[model samples]
Target chain A: MSVPTSTPELLRASVEQFYARHMQLLDDGDAEAWAETFTEDGLFALPGRPEPTRGRAALAEGARRAHTERLASHETHRHWHGMLDIRPQDDGSVHVRCYALVVATPRGGEPRLHRSCVCRDVLVPAGSQWQVRSRRVTRDGF
Target chain B: MSVPTSTPELLRASVEQFYARHMQLLDDGDAEAWAETFTEDGLFALPGRPEPTRGRAALAEGARRAHTERLASHETHRHWHGMLDIRPQDDGSVHVRCYALVVATPRGGEPRLHRSCVCRDVLVPAGSQWQVRSRRVTRDGF
Candidate 1:
């Protein structure tokens, strides 16, 4: 389990590329692409009092709500992500953890911290891209 | 980028082990180990309406309070984790996403959901053990 730090760096560039693509999809309000990031049976979870819901479609619905309903008029919504870890799987997929900060600027509204998510993701190579198989966004606090 | 399915399975097992150790530390009330699971400058965040606090010491203090003050007993606390995805990190760490359900059976009280988290975690391999560099837990609304 103890890998040389260099190993992670080897995948850094590609991971960053995937991460960038993910961010772009969100920032552009491309829910379809965002949902396509994961596999069909992929789970998108938001854990807390309501309990987490599974499946890609459910996750897509959540994303749609966040992008349109929450920030309908936000001309500028930026999300920054840093991958804390990316592990290669035996099936050629990768498991990754990423830290994120989402800043939303809604016309007259002050720039606010809309959400911060720690993404735990499973990615499979789809064509030349890494697509998500399952993802969980664990929100902190009650 | 084009890894096979087996990769996810291996990564899942590794992540499960990491969570098992983490839950053990909490249930056993092993504060040091619990804290040690984080990096020296790790962020144990509790995401909320407001931004979350960062760093290990803060996380340790929070954990202590939850273990002692928030709950009446830790004897019947059960942590069930599901749907985890693992990611490899730049510094020999792994990023993970999983759903957690903590049900506590207090003495003379109905079992309650003490904590339900969509855990986003970064785990670095320190020697042979995995340590958390960042954990962002987000709470869900009804």
Candidate 2:
């Protein structure tokens, strides 16, 4: 596969592709694979939560629980991310901020916007790809 | 401003910036400004529509009519584009295909997924920026 030559180009392209897969894994309820996109000691935090979910194991468990809830509700969720602002840090890590909207469609109903949130992540190069070192999500209006 | 040196990188960056402004103008209900992002003889087509809207004047009028309807409904629409696939053509134009979702929030109600669609565009260089030469949208499940 061809790769972007410059640092900014490379980082932007990597981040876009990373989210395409990451969001898909989440929507597909592949909790373990989704968590694997993060570092072994990745941190997932929310704005109002005092404690964050640390480590890939914890992240996977969290996602699994959410997936179970979604399954029980008979709703399929799709995460759409856009308006990405990617900045490459001096330490080779990239800081990305974007708007994410979760659309949930019930088994036989119209789709609704479940959540509108701002997602920020610190991504570090993991071999040829990138792994999320830390992620913080802030929901809109709260 | 620092620009990417390579052609691919430059095209990618230009496309991203172009959509950033283009979508914002549409959402803000700036019909004329939004239409100006297209070329003078731009074409807008839809899947089932027999005739496409041609020329900047017609595009602006169509956008204005939509804006009027949106105002009457007391709903605000936000266009979120993601998963962009950008390709540079041999003739200096760029082809961009992306998934675009419209989220509409009523005056006093929760937000809903207004529409899910695939947007494809042909963009050409307009001095230092890019303008849409032609656009086609295909609605999901239709």
* Residue lDDT tens for model 2, A79-138: 988877677777878887767788889999988787767688998887777889999996
Highest DockQ scorer: 2
Expressed as tens digits, the lDDT of each residue in B1-142 for candidate 1 is 2221124334445556668888888866676677777778877667552655456676677668767753555346767554454566555567676555566776767775554456788776666566677778754321
Native-vs-model 2 lDDT?
A: 0.82
Q: TM-score per model for chain B alone?
A: 0.75, 0.93
Local distance difference test, each candidate = 0.63, 0.82
How well is each residue in B1-142 modelled by candidate 2, as lDDT tens digits?
2432246775676577568668767876899999999999999997788899999999999899998998898877778888899887778777889998887777666677778999999988777768899999999989
The count of backbone overlaps in candidate 1 is 33
Candidate 2 ranges with C-alpha deviation above 4 Å:
A1-7, B1-9, B17-78, B82-109, B113-142
Q: What is the number of residue pairs that collide in model 2? A: 0
Hey, what RMSD does candidate 2 come out at?
Answer: 5.9
Please tell me what DockQ candidate 2 reaches: 0.21
Candidate 2 falls in which docking quality class?
incorrect
